[model samples]
Each structure stands twice: as structure tokens, then as C-alpha cells.
Target chain A: MNFFRKQSLSRWLIHLWFIIFSVFCLIPLVYVISISFSTESDLAVDGYRLIPKTFTTFAYKYLLKSPDQLITGYTVSVTVTVLGTVLSLLITAMLAYVLSRKDFRGANKLSFFIFFTLLFNGGLVPWYILIKKYLFIGDSIFALILPYVIMPWHVLLMKGFLSEIPLALIESAKIDGAKEWRIFWQIVLPIAKPAMATVGLFIAFVYWNDWWLAMLYIDNEKLIPLQYMLYRIMNNIQYLSSSIRPGTVNIDISQFPNETARMAIAVMAAGPILVVFPFFQKYFVKGLTVGAVKE
Target chain B: MSYQTKIHNSQPLANMNVKKKNTFWREFLRHKGLLALAAPGLLFVLIFNYAPMLGLVLAFKDFNFRKGIWGSDWVGLDNFKFFFTSDAAWQVTRNTIFLNFIFILLTNVVAIAFALMLFELSRRAVKLFQTTLFFPYFLSWVVVSYVTYALLNPQMGVINQLLTQFGFHEVNWYMEAKYWPVILSLAYLWKNVGYSTLIFYTGLMSIDKSLYEAASIDGASKWQQVRSISIPLLSPLITLITLLQVGKIFYSDFGMFYFLTADSGALYATTDVIDTYVFRALRVSGDTSMATAIGLYQSLVGFVLVVTVNYIVRRFNKDNAIF
Candidate 1:
């Protein structure tokens, strides 16, 4: 509480305690990275040592050598994430723009209709049956991207963000005879870039992190997203080693870097995002905090 | 309140009906473009959110897939009865609620403590700690499951290796049920606590700093300020978050339970929850109706629990109410 006065031991202790936690935080990731780069024998023998006794990309080599599944997984994940984020943002921003407008008739009810989904839902089976039977999107690429492309909560957050833009901007544009979509694209979208970026990042993350849909709808290898593919690979390791599904990969257990392969699969699945995660962290924190407060 | 009055109030003019009709048509016509723009999203929510809600009716049907949902023989409450009559009703319910109870409590304490510690730091220090802490928040649960496996793998796990070094026997973490409650919780905390901590930190920052400054002026110790000013102000946010989580207590994080254990049936005693239970049950029977029945029960119970909790919070503390 005192800026000028020093609280010697307590200050030192506080810093010490947090630094310890930071280390605790780093261990899992570091351990993961360490094992990912370790050779199979080293991983199996030394058993999750912080530093690998022998370092090799033996598993990565095998992973890359026969790369159909990995390529399929990556392509599906990237396509889904890109398309889902862009389309979702456009839809969310447009809807939020309409909802933010003070003069839109029944805006309150419409917003409530969207918001109601946040509090209640049809649950998994009904939703699954709807998509499977009616929407006819089960086991398709759209299946991976559609379910989460627009969320009601994100719409409300965008409305909150968009509402803060001065109404005169829209009013003046309307007086100039700009169409609804034009005004939304040119005037509203530019001003709401920060909010768009925030929402865009959120949407991208959801698409990237999602495996639930992949689990539910996808049975085809080509259609599988990376996360679920990694999920299959992990389980396949369990199954293959148990001889439940023989010769699925055509590699014996001891031959490939099996232990490191699972870890490596995880690393590769998350690797791209981790590379750029730091640049986006500050905005993510801000966006999530504001969203939480608003909720 | 005022809208209700306007709707019910009678007009004196004979032309009032014509005027009202004109206004309704005029307003509707004026908003046509806006409605057109909103139509797609409205449709999306209608199909995705509203249409599925209609499927809750499946709980009362026998669900013959070849015969279609409507053609399925109606079995009023039979599906629900079948679910509730089993041992699964108790087991999954207990596991779901128990895990959520532990998660809500532990995650809250850690987040708050971290938030408080974060508040005491310099701005640069805060950013550094936040970046490190939140790194894991970005990783998917599948990735996290491997990290858990790496640390808990009986023969190759870091923890087991450490135990062996110290002359303790290895822990067969996958086979063991007793340890998963803690293991799963710790895995969850490591992955999720960062984001929630940041949420609490933001709440902490919003506290009228004047309260703290004034308390310090009155020669209040740091602990006193935290106890009186910080904790009390944060209570509303705390309750809001807790109740939000409580609303979903019937639903467990499928990724957490499923992947962390690698679907090890050996550990289901401590780890299984409603989502997993339903999933496993569906796998065995391919019974869409049964799954829907369980889902409806879960959703209804959670909806009621949250509504009741929210109502009580609103009654006592109007400012903290979620709605």
C-alpha cells in the first residue's frame, strides 16, 4: 500500500512465490517439448526426464515419411479454421450491427432469441439428430465448421462492442443513402476493427480447439480435423500396442518413436498456434475480460 | 411496464383501427431491409438453437430411425424412467456434480490468490506473469492429455521417475481410480486457471482504487484492505462466475475426462460423468432416444439449478445478478 516505503521480506517472498508458480506453469510445457524432441528409446528408458538423454526427430521423420493422414488433418483444420472464422465474423458483425441500431424493430426480441440459446439448449442428441437428419451435413466438411460458426454469446459481445460506436456515424451514412450492407461494410466494420479482431481471434480459437464435432460426425479419415486425428493417433497407439487393430500403421511398436510420437503428435497439433500465441495474448486477455464482465 | 399499458389501452377514434394497422404495416415495411439482413442469423439460430429444442420431444418416443422421429411410437416417460431407474442415474450424477464442485472451488481459490498476487506487482511484472500463465490456456485438451500422460505415465512418467528416485513405488495412474479426482483437477487447473485468474484480475482492477487508497490513508494494513475492500467487491463477480459454472454442473468437460484417462475403463469409478456416461451408453446401444433422454434430464436439472441460484442471488444482491 505504501509506494515509498519498502516491505523487504514480504516483497521478496511475494516475488519468490510467483516465480515458483511460473516455473510450475512452464514444467508441463517444457516437459512436453522435451519429450516431443526426444528419441523413442530415450523417452521409454529415461521416462519423461526434463532433458532427453538422446535427442532425435526419429518420430517426426516417420510422421513425415508417410504423411497422408497428417496432410489430410492439416488441410482440413486450416480450411475449417479460416472459412469458419471469416464467415462467422462477417455474420456476427452484420447481425450485431443490426442489433446495435437503435431503430431496428423487434431488435430486443431478436437479441433475446439469440441470447436465449446461451441459457438453454436442445442438448447434444437432439442437436446431433437435427444436423444428421435435417441439415444433412453429417460427415461433411461443413459439419466441422457449421455448428460453432455463430454463437449467441459472441453475437451479444459484438453487439456490446458495436453499440459503443457513435450512432451519428450510422445516421450520417444513412442520410447519404448508403444501403444497409454498404454502411455496415465501409463505415461500421472499419471503426469496429479492434472488436472484429477480438471476435475473429475468439472464433479462430474455437475452431482450432474444437474436436467434439469431429468426434461426433467424422468417421472418414480425409474429413478428420487435426485435433481429432491426434485423438485417433493417441488411441491408435493404445490400440495398436494392444494388438486390437493390427498393422494399421504398418510399423512395429519398438521400431518407431511410439512414446515421443504421441507427444510429438500433440506438439505438432498445437505447434502452429503456440508460435504466434504470444503476439495475440494481450488482445485475447482484454477480449476475454471484457466479455466476462459483460456476461 | 409502460409497453403493456399501451397495448391494452383503448382508443376513442373510429379510425384508430385503421391507424394502428397502418403503423404496424409501416413499421414492418420500414424494417424489411434489417429483417432481411438478420434473416440468415435468425435462420441459423432457428435451426441450430430452436429446432433442436423441438427434438426434446424425442425423450417421449421410442426413436425408430428408419421410421423417422414422428413415426416412432410414443412411450410417455418410459425413456426417462429407464434412465432414472438405473444405477447410472446416481453414478453419473454424483460424478458430474462432485467434479464440478471441486473444480469451482479449487479454480476460484487459485484464480483469486493469483489475482491478488498479480495486483501487488508492477505493471511489467504483471504482464510477464500473465503471458506465462496464459500460455497453457491456448492449448487444446488433447494436447493437455499428452502432457498429463507424460507426467503420469507409470513407466515413463516424470512423477513416477521422481518417486522411484526417492525409493517410492510407481503410481499406475491410468489404472488407478482414487488419484484421478486430484489428477484431473490439477490438469484442469494448469490449463484453465490462467484465463480465470486474468478475469479475476480485471475484476480486482475495477474496484474503486479510492477504497484502497483511503484505507491506506487510515493506516490499514495491506491484509485488512484486501479482506475488507478487495474480497467484498470481488464477491459479486465470484458468485456470478460460480453460479454460471454451477449451471453446467450436470455437464462435465468431455475432453478432460475422456482423453486424460485415454478412455481407461479402469478409472471410470472416479472419473466418469454424465457426458461420458451418455457417450459410452450411446456407443453400446446406438440409442439416440436414450441419449436425448439423458441429455434433457441433465439440461433441465442444470437449468433449474442455475435459475434458482440466480434468483436467490438477485433477491439478496441485485447488482451481482447474471441476467
Candidate 2:
């Protein structure tokens, strides 16, 4: 009876610790969300409050008033994400299916060809020159999507998932006079939906979060994605205050909500993706399981 | 020969002949739809990945704006000499390797602990906790930088505000090089603990439940069961993660260093790493050749590191080696 009581006490303590740790992970995010809605004056006075002492959307309002740049950034990010995901999924699935086949000649060679790139690469300068010279992808949307598509890791994951599908299905389809194309498209793709969603979400996230390619190949202000634009805005603000004079006389540097604006841009940039993440978490878990366990 | 025997033999031989006549091109054309499916991905890798590989020659050339990459004059080892001779080389390399070593050790320890704790929770609670914990992984470094600034900013920052409120002097965190190694590690842990936890959790889940059941029957305490059963089963995964990290020890997380430090020169002593050092040398100083040289050095070292590590791992356990 005493031992039973002690066990229950330990269980309660474990629960308490779990709750505390969860709060630790979540509170900072909650703080950012609340501050995004707080008035600038209240923020300055209160420092960072858990709850908004005085609520206002002025930071968002300022951003919305000059919404052209923000909207363009959003459009570029969205287009790149969508196109990149679809293209990446298609390629990953096809190559995965081909490589998964038992009798496919050169499958091992092709796999190695894909895998070698993950370990060794030419590094940044050469890669930058390649994109600029051979691909001619500078200052374009392709600059964002082209570099990220078909990661070797994702291909390996997709291949592992495809390998799990029974070989009998392919053999039976072939016996029925079904072409390899028809067999793959009709049979293989349908079964690989979970893997596709997982790989697609990952590819989409990479494209959405990317600023590296933009930093390297993209210099035109109009072509900037949201993250890169936010990066530039931060740098631009610093430049304006220290280096360049604003072209207009009426604009006062002191009135600008630099701190609040930085937070607001962060909220705008990350908000939609965070909203979509939970829905995709299931697929992500499945995808990660295959990749992590196999590798 | 008997008629039935001859007919059976000829039928099997005819099938083999048909299979042999199916050439590579014919089989490839037969799978044209699959080829079409592969086209976009192949094109993407071709344009982005493979094309970049061809540009590696630029490291040996003086990049003249008028002459371009191929048209430029060959500079031989001058670029490499500039890189090796510079003071930045040793500092950046040391910083990269040292910081990465600390991160690998610390992150693995915490992640393993978190995973163990997670296994103790009930199913419903585990789901809730995981979602919350994994939230930070989705955020970019830029956003994470803001979170850091909110805490560390000199004037109205929360840390400073709290310090002054406690009757302590507020330190200028941005100007101090000493605080960054700790701060950067904390930031890295906060952003990544969830990912490592998830990986470790998956490893835990894969362990056969029967082993734990048998251990309990053998009069084992929870701690004993974990120590004997769980830790042993998790060793391979732990090794795998560590080995992969070791391969990239020469490279730094550029976003973490660049954004969190806010590119302040004051923090360069403790924080400047190979990637950031090269960025400063190339973009800021307009020394493209030196940057290329440093980049080449990093790549070569990273490649050799991975190969050496993989070889060592293969010696211990062939199955776990990445190759």
C-alpha cells in the first residue's frame, strides 16, 4: 500500500515536469503573438508583457498601408512554394519508383549519383557562379525554386517508402498488359500519397523559408521573397539611419517604429506557415519516420 | 525426342529469347511515363546542382568583370595562398570546430533526456507536448533573432529591464563577445531540441516493448530498465546522429551567427566562423578570390572529415556507416 502511494506521487511529479517544460517551449511564441497586437507606446513602456496592456494593430496598419511590397513578397513566396513542391514531388516519386524496382538496370548507379552530392559539393562561390552564368537564373523566380528541388535526402526517403509497396502489384499489372507508365501512374502514385504529402510539405517549407539563393543571385528589390525582403528591410533600416539620407524631407527617422516594424514583419512572414503546419504534422511524422529509421 | 518434351523445352527457350531481345532503349521507351515524371526533378538538379559543379574552376581564376569566369586569367595557387596566409583562417576554423563539438555533445545529451522523459508521459499528453515543443523548429533564424533581441537588447530589453529591477547593472550584451557562445548555444538548443527529441523519440518507439516487459518481470526498477534496456537499444541511433554531425563540424550555421550577432564587429572574436568570415572578406572587402579560396578549403576539409568519419564508423559497424 505504501509503495503504491509512492508510485502515484512520482507519476504526478513527472506530469508536473512535463507541463512546465511545455510551457517553457510555448511561452516565448505566445509572447511574440501578444506583442504583435500591442500598441507601440505600450510596448516601449511595458517592455514585453504576457498580455497586451493596451491593444492596437498600428504595426499591422503601417505594414498594410504600404502593402505593395509585402503583397509582392507573399506572391513570390507562394508561387515558388507551390511550383517547387509540385515539381519536386513529381520527380522524387518517379525516381523513387524507378529505383525501387528490383530489375531496373543502372538503379544502383543512379542512386549513387544522387547520393554523392549530399556529402560533397563545390561550396558557395562556385555554386553562385554556376547559377549566375550557366543557368542564367539571376534576378528571377527560378533562382528561388531551381536550387532546392530534388534534395537527395528526400529522394532516398521516397525510395524507401516506395520499396515498401509489394512487388506483386507491379508484376500483376505487367501480366495484365498494363504499360510501365500506366502501372506507375495508376498503381504506384496512389499508394504513395502519404510519402508525397510528406516530401511535398518538406520541399514547400524549404522554398518558403529560403533566403540564401535570393541573397546570392537576386539583387533586384522587386523580386525579393518575403524572408529576403524582411532581411533587406532590417538592413535597409540600419543603412537609412547610419548611411543613406531618405530622399524626402518630410519623413522623420524618429517616428518610424523600427522595433515594432521588425516584429510585425516577422509575424507576417511566419504566420501563415505556422497556421498550416499542424495539419501537415501527421504526414511529417510519417515521412520523418521512414527517413530517420532507414538512414 | 518425345513431342511433348520438345514443345515444353522450345516454349521456355522462346520466352528467354523474347526477354533477351528487349534492349535498353526499348525498355526505356516502355517506361516513358516514368521518365516524364522524372524530367522536372532531373532538370532542376541539372540546372541548379550539376551546373554549379562545373563552376568550381573559378576558384583557380582571377574573376575579372570584363573577362567573366571562363574568360578570366588563371591565377594558379595565389587565391589559396592568400587564404592560408591570412589570420582569419585559423580563427574561423577553430571557432567552427569548437562550437560544433560543444553543440553536438550538449544537444545529444539533452535530446536523449527529453526523449526519455517523453516516454514516461501518457499518449494524450505526449501528443500535446510534442506539438508545442516542435513549434520553434518552424521559425526562421530572422524571427529567432528578434526573440533574442527582445531578451538581450541593451536599452529596453527584458533581460536588462529585469537586471535593473533587481538592483543590478545592465550589461551591453551586443557589445560583449564573452556572452555570445553561451547565448548562441541556448538559441540553437531552443530552436532544435524539438527536432532532436522527435528523432530520439522515434528511436525509443522502435525498441521492442517485450524487452521492457521482461526486465520488469526480472525485478528491475524503472531506472534500471532504462539504463540497461533503453540506453543500449538507443546507442546505434545516438552514434548515427553524432557521426553525421561530425562530418559537418567545419561548417557553421551562418544564419544563427549572422542574425543573432547582428553582424556586430565587437562579437567577432568569439563568434566569427568560416562562413561568416568568408562573407565578410568577399562581399564587404570585395576580395572575391580570397573568399573562393576559403570556400575551397572548407569544402575539402569537410569532405575529408566525412570520409574519415565514415571509414571509422564502418570499421566499428558497417551497417551504421552512411555509405
Candidate 3:
């Protein structure tokens, strides 16, 4: 009876700890969301709050009033993410499928060729110059899409998934005179749907969340993605805040809805992924766990 | 008679050469479809990955805008000397290694602990906790910076408001270099720990329940079962993740360091890392040659570390070795 009590106590303790930590994880996001919904005057007076004293859509309304930049950012981000994800998935799956075939000559060598990139690269300079100078891809959509298209890590993850299908499955198809491409399309792809979703979501996230490529290659305002847009807005805010004198009492930062609007932009930029990911959480967990353990 | 013998010997030798060539060609014809499937990706990799590798030679060249990579004047060791002699070199290098070491150590310990705790829960409870815990991981560092700003904003930030309420002096979180190491680590954990916790939880789930039952039957406590069965089994994974992180200690997550600090020049003392430093040198300072040199240094050291660590891992567990 004492042992049972002790075990239950510990279990309850775990529950309590997780609840607290989970709250800790969520507080920042909750605070930001709350501030985004609150009016600028309330924010200035109350600072940031987990719950707003008064709720208004003033910030979001302000953002929507001049939604040209926001619209362009959304359109570009969505276009690149969708295009990049599909193309990356196809390319990665094909390469991985080839390497997954034990019967294929040079499979091991080719696998090593892909894996070596994960270990080392020429670093940022050559890569930047190659795309910018040699390829002339700067300020283009391809600049964003091309660089991340054949991520070595994703290729390997897909390879790990693909190699698990039985060789006899492919052999029987080959016996029926199905070509390698046909076998890959007809037999392999349908079975690899879960892995595809997992890897595709990951690739999509990379394309969507990325600002690094844009920062380096993009100088055109029209080409900026959502994250980079958010980055710019935040950058300006930081500059504004830092440039002000510490002792100035008369300057009201909130007179312009910039503070609340920045948070709203952030919320909008990050909102879609947060909303979409929960539905795919199971596959996300499976992919990450399997990838970690298997690798 | 000699002429006839020479002709006879040469005839079979010529046939043998043709046969050897035919075998290779036949094999190529057979695998042509597979090669076709791989070609697009192979081409991309060659351009994006391999081309830059060849372009590492730019590290030794004085980059002239009008002159291309091939036509640039060779200035052997000068770019490297520029990087090594700079004061930023030691600072960034030390910060990268030290901070990554702390992050790996702190986050993994916390993750493992959390994973163990969750291992004690029921399925429904685990699901609920996981949903909330993993929420932060989806936010980009750019967004997280906004969240960070809301807290650390000098005047009207929440922490400052709270500090004044408690009769303590408000902290200027952004300007203070001393606070960033802790702040960054906490931010790192907030965004990352859940992913790793779930990983460790998955690892823990794979452990045989029969062992725990058998231990309990022998009067072992839950703690004993964990220490004896769980930790020992989980060590392989923990070691693998740690060693993998150690391999990339030279590279910081540029997004985190860049966005969270908002590239503040004030906090560069503690927060500047090799990656951010390289970016600033290349873009902000327009010192392409020096940046390339630093990049080369990072890549070579990173490669050696990864290869060495992989070798060490392979010595014990072949499957665990990344290569």
C-alpha cells in the first residue's frame, strides 16, 4: 500500500511539473498574441500582459490598411514553399530511391557522395558567390528555391525510409517487365506516402521559415518572404527603440501602432504553420523519432 | 608460318578487348533508367554543393569584382593571416565552442529528465503535455525575437514591469552583454528542448516493459528501474546526439544568434559566433577574401571533428556512426 502511494505521488508530481513547464513554454506566445490583440495605448500603459485589459483589432486593422507588403510577402512565401517542397520531395525521393536500391551499381559510392556534404562544405562565401556571381540567381525566386532543393539530410532520411521496403517487392515488378522508373512510380511511391508527408512538411517548413537565403541574395523588396518581412519590421523597431535617448520622458513609442502591429505581423507570419502542424503532429513525431534513432 | 601465327594471336586479343567494352556498355544500358532518375538531383548537387567546394580556392585569392574566380590574383595565406590576426577571431571561436557546449549539456540533461518524467504518465496525459511543449518549436527565430522583444523591451516590457512591482530595479535586457549567455541558453531550450524530449521519450518507449516488470517483481523501486534499465539503454542515443552536436560546435545556429540579439553590437562580446561573424565580414564589411578564409577554417575544422567523432563512435557501435 505504501509503495502504491509513493508511485502515485511521483506520477502526480510528474503531472504537476509538466503542467508548469508547458505553461512556461506557452507564456511568451500567449503574451505576444494578447499584445497583438490589444490597442497600442493599452500596451504602452500596461506593458505586455498575458491577458489584455481591453481587446481591439486596431493593430490588425492597421496592418490590413496597407496590406501591399503583407500580401506580397504571403504570396511569395506561399509560392516558394509550395514549389520548393514538391520539387525537393520529388528530387530527394528519386535520388534516395536510386541509392536505396542495393542492386544498383555505385549505390554505396553515391550514398557517400551525398553524405559527405553533411560533414563539410566550402562554407558560406563560395556558396554565396557561386549563386550570386556565377549563377546570377540573385534577386530571383530561384535563388530561394534552388539552394535548398537537394538537402542532403532530407535525401538520407528518405533513403532510410525507402530502403525498408522489401527487395522482393521490386524484384517481382522487374520480373513483370516494369522499368525502374515505372516501378518507382507504381510500386514505391504509394507505399512511401507517410515518409513523403513527413519529409515534405519538413522541406516546406525550411522554405517557409527561411530568411537566410533572402537576406544574402535578395535586395529587391518585391522578393522578400514572410519571415524576412517580419525580420525587417522587427529590425526597424529595434533601431527605433535603440536610437531614442534613455532619459527622454516625452517620446511616446506607441503613438504610432508600430509596436502592436509588429507583433501582429509576427503572429500572422507564424500562424499558419502552428495551425497546420497539429494535424500532422503524428507524422512529425514519427519522422523525427525514427530519424534520430535510425541515424 | 611466322606471319600466320602473329595474325592468329592478334585476332583473339582484338575480340577480347571488344568483349570487355561491350560488358561495360551493356551494364550502362541496363541501369540507364536509374541513372535518369538520379540525374536532376545529381546535377543540382554538383552545381550547388560540389562547385562551391571547388570554389574554396577563392579563400587564397584576392577577390577582384571585375576578375572572376579563375582570373583572380593568387594571394596565398594572406586571407588566412587576415582572419587569424583579427581580434574577433578568438572571441567568436571561443564563444561558439563554449556556448554550444553549454547548450548541448544543459538542453540534453533537461530533455532527458523531461522525457523520463513523461515516461511515467498515461497516454492521454503524454499527448496533452507533448502538444503544448512542442508548440514553441514551430515558431521561427524571427518570431521568437518579437516574443523576446516583448519581454526585454527596455521600458514597457513585462519583466521590467514585474521587477518594479517586486521592488527591484528594472533590467535593460538588450543592452547588457552579461545576461545574454543565460538568455540565449534559455531561448535555445524553449525552442528546442521539446523536440529532443520527444526523441528521448521515443527511445524510452522502445525499452522492454518486461525488464521494468521483472525489476519491480524483484523489489526494485521506480528510480532503480530507471537508473538500471532506462538510463543505460538510453545512453547510446544520448551519446550519439551529443557527439553529433559536438561535431558542429564551430557552427552556431545563425538565425537564433542573429535574430535574438537583433544583431546588437552591444552583445557581440558574448553572443557573436563564427557563423554571424562570417556573415558580417562578407556582407556588412564587404571583406569577401577574409570571410572566405574564416569559412574555410570553420569547414576544415568541422570536417575533421565530424570524421574523428564518427570514427570514435564506430569503434563502439557501428550502427551509431553517422557515416
lDDT of 2: 0.77
Estimate candidate 3's alpha-carbon lDDT, on a 0 to 1 scale: 0.86
Ten residues in sequence with the least summed lDDT for candidate 3 chain A: A286-295
RMSD in order of candidates: 4.3, 5.7, 4.2
For model 1, how does the per-residue alpha-carbon lDDT over B104-164 read when each residue is reduced to its tens digit?
8999899999999889888778888888888788788888888887788666788998998
Better of 1 and 2 by lDDT: 1
What class would a CAPRI assessor give candidate 2's docking? Answer: acceptable
Model 2 chain B scores worst on lDDT over the 10 consecutive residues at: B15-24
- DockQ, model 2, C-alpha based: 0.42
Task: Give lDDT per model, in order.
Answer: 0.81, 0.77, 0.86
Compared to the true structure, candidate 2 yields what TM-score? Answer: 0.88
Candidate 3 Cα misplacement greater than 4 A, ranges: A1-3, A245-251, A289-295, B1-30, B206-221, B314-320
Candidate with better TM-score, 1 vs 2: 1
lDDT of 2 at A126: 70
How do all models score by TM-score? 0.90, 0.88, 0.91
Compute the lDDT of residue B142 as modeled in candidate 1.
Answer: 89
Better of 1 and 2 by DockQ: 1
Query: Which candidate has the highest DockQ of all?
Result: 3
DockQ of each: 0.56, 0.42, 0.66
Candidate 1 to truth, TM? 0.90
Q: Model 1, which residues run further than 4 Å from truth?
A: A1-12, A101-105, A172-179, A242-257, A289-295, B1-34, B207-221
